[model samples]
Target: MNMVEHPGFVLWFTGLSGAGKTTIAVALEAQLRERGMRLERLDGDTVRQGLTRDLGFSKEDRDKNIERVTFVAKLLSRNNVAVLASFISPYIAHRDGVRAETTHFIEVFVDAPLEICAQRDVKGMYKKAFAGEIKNFTGVSDPYEPPINPEIHIHTDQETVDESVQRIVTWLEERQYIPAKVTA
Candidate 1:
């Protein structure tokens, strides 16, 4: 079967912690890779360990983090690589900056209520934040500005991971960013 070649795009996932951004990105990445798409995943946790290791969670640091990631995403997406970035990215200005810098940018708001996110926190981050152990936590001490008009929005508390992935894939296909899957 012949494969469809498409231009590069950035699928940016943004939400508060434990809101299922990474989960959906991981599933969507698997699907895209299976379809033979060249892909890169720039996750917040992994990026912080390396690219933004020196940065704290201050507003300035958050901006710098997204700025660096945006630079990388811009280069890769323009070169026809699918860039999947999952970040808290709590500010609208930073996200808008990335959209302006990248090619075919698609913002995905993975939304879940603070209570739901806290319940889903396997890393105990929410617990610590509630206990005053963690400062500058989004949805807690820090502000997380929800996307005013994202390309896609998924409510993790309501939708299953598969449902969320399918929604994104369908959107991409509809927009011709990715061709519809061929079934045997």
Candidate 2:
């Protein structure tokens, strides 16, 4: 298939829950939008409520959820719409499966320690997981395989949101995934 007029790619944000994937994704989406990029932000929780509503936390269901997201991302990218996907895609195989389908894939690992994430959890998922209320919870009951070699790694614990956004913008410019904006 022919490429879109403007380059479009998958900016995949993968990490543990409360690892700042959504925070970074939201800011990045805004910046990209300001730059006039046609894009979509497909967050895990939002997708779960809709497309993956029937899917549970089982590995099989998780895989199916990711597969659905990947399919949507592929469709958008093929039309030159960038995708900012934030998911706790803990399985390497699942992440790799999505990667294999995208033409321009940038895997970003939003790194944060489990303890820190737990401390910052507004949804109380970590608290519930620790209390045995939630099963198959990534980092609590499920496995979260970090990307072996992610294109970008955001240490969310150490960096402020602005700093992280700047880092990603720098990376995007360096890679020419997005056009560099001219300052007035």
Candidate 3:
């Protein structure tokens, strides 16, 4: 389907905090850059700090945040940029809304146990949530609904960063979104 000519698409990564969504997204972005692809990365934490600073963590606010991100990602894709997003978009309806807005939406579920994620709290988010410093936190005070049928399921516990990146890159190539290396 000549994805490159159609402005590429979005690779949406969803999961609980510390689930390695941002880690995988960053690795994939670096790999894609190495392959000379135009790309944009939108991580939920960073987005909230800037574009969605005023938004709270309420269900409505979360939905609105995802809606804004979906629009921005779709626009970037329409301009021939591969948009990669890492967010804990915790609702089926919100994810479906994003899918409806973009033609090439690849949902990558970063599936990791809450206990594992809590242990790997690189940013101290889990600690804050557990201490009641952060309210409405997914997998803690709030809920995290897993994807019913994600395009790819990345179990961070079982795979290394390189392996995860390779899996995603292979998916892009197999789906014809990117060119494959020619056999000698």
What TM-scores do the predictions have?
Answer: 0.96, 0.95, 0.92
Q: Candidate 1, which segments miss by more than 4 Å at Cα?
A: 1-4
Instruction: Name the runs in model 2 displaced over 4 angstroms.
Output: 1-5, 182-184
- Over 90-139, each residue of candidate 2 has an lDDT whose tens digit, in order, gives 99998899899986889999999999999998689998999999999999
lDDT of each: 0.93, 0.90, 0.88
The prediction achieving the highest TM-score against the true structure is 1
Using lDDT as the yardstick, the better of models 1 and 3 is: 1
Q: Give lDDT tens digits, candidate 3, residues 1-184.
A: 1222324789999999888999999988876776667789999989999999999999989988999998898888877789999999999899999998985899999999999999989898899999999999899999999999999999999999899889998988888886554333
- lDDT for 42 (candidate 2): 95
Instruction: At residue 66, give the lDDT of candidate 3.
Output: 95
| Clashes per candidate (backbone, < 3 Å) | 0, 0, 1
| Rank by lDDT (best first) | 1, 2, 3
Give candidate 2's error at residue 62 in angstroms.
0.5
Off by over 4 Å in 3: 1-7, 181-184
For 1-184, candidate 1 gives per-residue lDDT tens digits of: 3445988999999999999989899999989877878889999999999999999999989988999999999999999989999999999999999999999999999999999999988699999999999999999999999999999999998989999999999999999898666665
Task: Return whichever of 1 and 2 wins on lDDT.
Answer: 1
